[model samples]
Target: MCAPKGAAALYVRDGLRLEPVVHGGGQEHGVRAGTENVALAVALGAAGLAADDLADGAPARIAALRDELHQRLAAAPPGCVRLNRPERKRLPNTLNVSIDDALGHELRAAAHGIAASTGSACHRGNHTPFDLARSLGALRLSLGRWSTADDIETTADAAIKSATER
Candidate 1:
């Protein structure tokens, strides 16, 4: 069920139904009743449309960036790092590399300049691994729309340097 916003259309075509968890008007859908947020719905629809338009081109761009990042990081000394997600099955923008020698807390503290996460933002400052990571025995590094080639290079360099120095 976890997919990018661009893939929602595909899911819809695959017969996945999204029932309203909360309805705006009473007796409209027989779901939870509440006032509808028309503005939010319009914004979401617009964003989805934009994503759909760019999805075809996005995958290739993301893949190239991801490959470059992996190539850079994989060159680091052995036992210093490990990739959490298998390359083939992972989201293209994600590169969840594990600093095997450093704790997540230490990594976070060291990565002061880079806007990266040890795991999930929801668990920020909690000194805990993401719930998913805790359950699955893996860490995470989620990339997003703002991620650039330079950002990747800087982040990877900083991370590797930090891990080595630690």
Candidate 2:
């Protein structure tokens, strides 16, 4: 899902006086608009609540596990790995590391036991680097509610071993 800030930033910086290029539905704060999706709105609200609940203890737990994995993997072998996201600023449950010689697709193909992604699922078949990585030169790894201490340990071990072998 797209973060809301980019569009909001454009509107704020450009002023709200632009004319519509195409018109079908009613106006929306001088931007193009259609009928609001009530169901989606409700779902978003529910998600916000769920996120709030997850924020209570999830961040600290995930951060601890992530730090452990990073430290251990970084200590494993010389020139084997590099963490993509800064440890402090990164999302707690996410870990993106680049292997010096390993292609993301190859790791993904061989990682049969771990639930991980080379990048966003949306751009999987595009044969291009992840947009964020293209802009900043980093891989992307996302973790979710089901991610666990075991998963992190297992995945980090597999990643380090794979990178070393390659």
Candidate 3:
């Protein structure tokens, strides 16, 4: 609930008069009127302010942890785990991989504490074409502000073990 991205700010271009899908007696002079989630709006504003105050190096640090996790997982025997895309093109905090001889959902279940989903996060956004049409042997790992080196180590070990189980 603390994550306020669900309903946040909206930007309309200058000289653009857009029509709202829902027209009712509401806020903003009744232009697309609806009851707003006041609490969520306040939390979103607070989160934005907090984000602006974050250290410039925070993203880089998280990316480093992401890279380290990939490296540790890659140390597994060749072909056991495959990086689906080059890191340079992806969001620094998301890693997408496919395990040999195993399905993505299976890997997810076997990895235990790791929280992830089958295929890449891109799959949900239509960025990946092969996941649904084939074996679905893809996994997406997301790292964030709270991720630590120990978390990376544990994740890598668990994923490798799960993949190598064959």
Point out where model 2 deviates above 4 Å: 1-23, 27-32, 119-139
**Local error of candidate 1 at 146, Å?**
2.8
Instruction: Return the TM-score for candidate 1, rounded to 2 decimals.
Output: 0.67
Worst 10 residues of 2 by lDDT: 1-10
lDDT per residue (tens digit) for residues 46-139 in model 1: 6664466366576667767877877786788665566766768767777767655466656656765776655665755665444443323233
- lDDT (tens digit, per residue) of candidate 3 on 42-124: 77767764464255666788888989988887778664667878858677788888776678888889998889877553447
Candidates 1 and 3 compared: the better one by TM-score is 3
- 1 versus 2: better lDDT goes to: 2
- Against the correct fold, how does model 3 do in TM-score? 0.82
Encode model 2's per-residue lDDT on 1-166: one tens digit a residue: 2223222223345544776666767656646667656666555545554466466776777777777777776777765667776657878877777665567766665655766666666765666544443323234556655667788778777766666665
Please name the candidate that would achieve the greatest TM-score relative to the true structure. Answer: 3
Cα lDDT listed for each candidate: 0.61, 0.63, 0.76
Q: Model 1, 147: alpha-carbon shift in Å?
A: 1.9
Q: Which stretches of candidate 3 lie over 4 Å from their true place?
A: 53-55, 120-135
Q: Model 1 RMSD to the real structure?
A: 5.9
Alpha-carbon TM-score of each model against the true structure? 0.67, 0.61, 0.82
RMSD in angstroms, all models? 5.9, 6.1, 3.1
